[model samples]
Target: MKLLRAIGHLIITIFLTALTQVGGLIWLLVLLLASKFKLKKRYLFPMVYLVFNLLLVPPVAKYFGREQLPVFDKDLKPRHYLYPLLFRNYVVPEMKTLLEQSAEHLKYQSIGITYLDANFPFLDGFPLLPHLSHSDGKKIDLSFQYVNSKHQPTDKKPSLSGYGVFALSEQNFTSNSCIENGYWQYDYSKYLTFGTINDLNFDSKNTKLLIQELLKYPSAQKLFIEPHLKQSLGLGHMDKIRFHGCQAVRHDDHIHLQIR
Candidate 1:
């Protein structure tokens, strides 16, 4: 009886040690993965740790009430807009109108506009503009279809035209006011026509015309012309205007228009 008890205790000790080692390795893996990837650190890392502890630590399971994992039922109806990508601030109706008009002009059947920092689960591969980082409540990032010659939606970027309209140049800056507030300040006289460009094709004149039409909506007050064009148009002459907004800092890949 004494020998049997000792053997049982020895087995328990080995099992507990192995369990602790496995748990430690899992935690180490989580740390390594989190550090290596540039994803949401706060939301993802803690969730991983919590799941790990709950599964491997018997004490955690006992304290938290272990239950079978819930299974998703396909028969159940899904909610409409069930998981909308949440934005930092609510978008104004005027902005929504502008986005809708733009989408319509492009003949895109599906389009969406939300605050710049909206959490887009579907757009993980695409490089999101910096203005969409949610720092300012005014900026927004839009997603829409870029149609091809066949009238079908394609994952292509759009193109813009007109020298002063979309091009950032030194001539655009007429005064010091445009420079002082990191180029956040604007004057109507300095305004120019602008359009979107994608895939090195500038034939999308229809998109530019559509933008012009949208600007007529009274809400399209502050149109964010591309910084490259701004520089090309002489807006870069002033140090302040050259680096104003997030676009001035290499996020100029996309346009962030502000409707007043």
Candidate 2:
């Protein structure tokens, strides 16, 4: 029982660390306090995690040249509250401004920008797993715009987690070729969506406009999306829009933006 419990704790630690940069440390701290004082993991976990994330991480992150994106805003917002709660929404100040300016440009058209995972606070090289380049606060993912069943634009995403739902069929030739070439992880993001709505349609026009607006910023470096989407959106001429390669998952579901 002791060995099994030790293994369980190890697994949880790794999982938490991978999901949230500081979570494993917090979990270990909870264990330490619990072992010494007979505290409950259930209550202590939330209490300590919230205290560190809410109180300690933000200001400290700012000093490291990172800023947290807002949970709610008129122009830009996170896809889910968990992003900010887990400290997965920190970015360089210029990146934040780029997103805000892009969103504001689309506000008049009634389109809102929904951002996904950015970077972990307080680390220059710590990886934000599943993304090869988000570690430095220079990269972020943005969800694609989608229309509801009624064909009206909505801020709500097809995938509740703002990932995994491919804009077009995942079985397309590019995905198939990549997977067949031993890149099974090419479409692995499909498993990460917490839940999905089946009736959403990709909003091509507004999404294209959003991309255009983002590219207008001098800080904007490049954007990653699928080839099919680039063709579908008539964005083939834009040199800034490029394929992320088979090593990375498909990007039709979202845009990967980077700044210099």
Candidate 3:
């Protein structure tokens, strides 16, 4: 039983660490304190975690050259609230400025930029899992604009997680080529999308403008998206826009932006 309990703790530590960079250590601390203080483990865990994230992580992260993305900023925000709490919203100061400026440029058009998993705080090369390249604070994922069934634009994402729900073109050249080459996990994000707005359609016009605005910044290095989207959006001439390669997952659902 002692060995079994040790294994359980190890598994939880790894899982929490993978999901939230600092969570494993905090979980362990909570485990020790909860037993000593006789507090309810179930409730104490989240309460302590939330307090740590809010009071400690952000300030410490800044000292290491990573700034946490704003959770409620009107110009730029995370696709899900959990992103900030999970410490998946940290980025270099320049990258944050680039995103905010791009969003501000599109503010007149009512095109909001909703970001997804970025690098974790406190580590320069610690893998963010599922997104290996996002280890650095220079990379981030942005959700593309989508419209409801009535053809009216909405902030509501088709997928609960703002991932998956691919915006496929009539001919999915890049997607097919990647899958045909034996990369089975290429389109795996589809499963991560908890059933949400199934009828939402990709808003090409707004999404195109958003990309264009982002590319206007000199600090913007490269934007990885599927080739079909580049052709459809008429962004073929943009030098900063490039294919992410088959090694990474498809980018038809969101734009992967990186800075110099």
Name the top lDDT candidate. 2
Please, what is the TM-score per model? 0.34, 0.92, 0.96
Q: Candidate 2: which stretches are off by over 4 Å?
A: 1-7, 170-172
Tens digits of lDDT, candidate 1, 1-260: 98996577466544433333233344455546766895554566457645653444433323322211111221111111211211112234445455555545444523222112322211122222322342222335332224566665444444331111222233334333344555552332223214444443222343344334445666665545445544443444432222334324222333445554
RMSD of each: 16.9, 1.9, 1.3
**How does model 3 score by TM-score?**
0.96
Ranking the candidates on TM-score from highest down gives 3, 2, 1
Give the per-residue lDDT of model 2 (tens digit) for 1-260: 99999999999999999889989999999999999999999999999999988898889888999998888795799988889887899999999999888887799999999999999987799989878889999999999888889999888888888999888775367888899999989999999999996688999999999999999888899999988889889999999999899999989889999999
Q: Select the stronger candidate by TM-score from 1 and 2.
A: 2
Best prediction by TM-score: 3
The TM-score measured for candidate 2 stands at: 0.92
Backbone clashes for every candidate come to 25, 0, 0
Candidate 3, 202: how far from true, in Å? 1.0
Clashing pairs in 2: none
| Candidate 2: worst-modelled 10 consecutive residues by lDDT | 167-176
* Candidate 3, 112-218: lDDT as tens digits: 99998988988888889888599889999999998988999877788888988888655568788888999888989888887666678999999999999998988
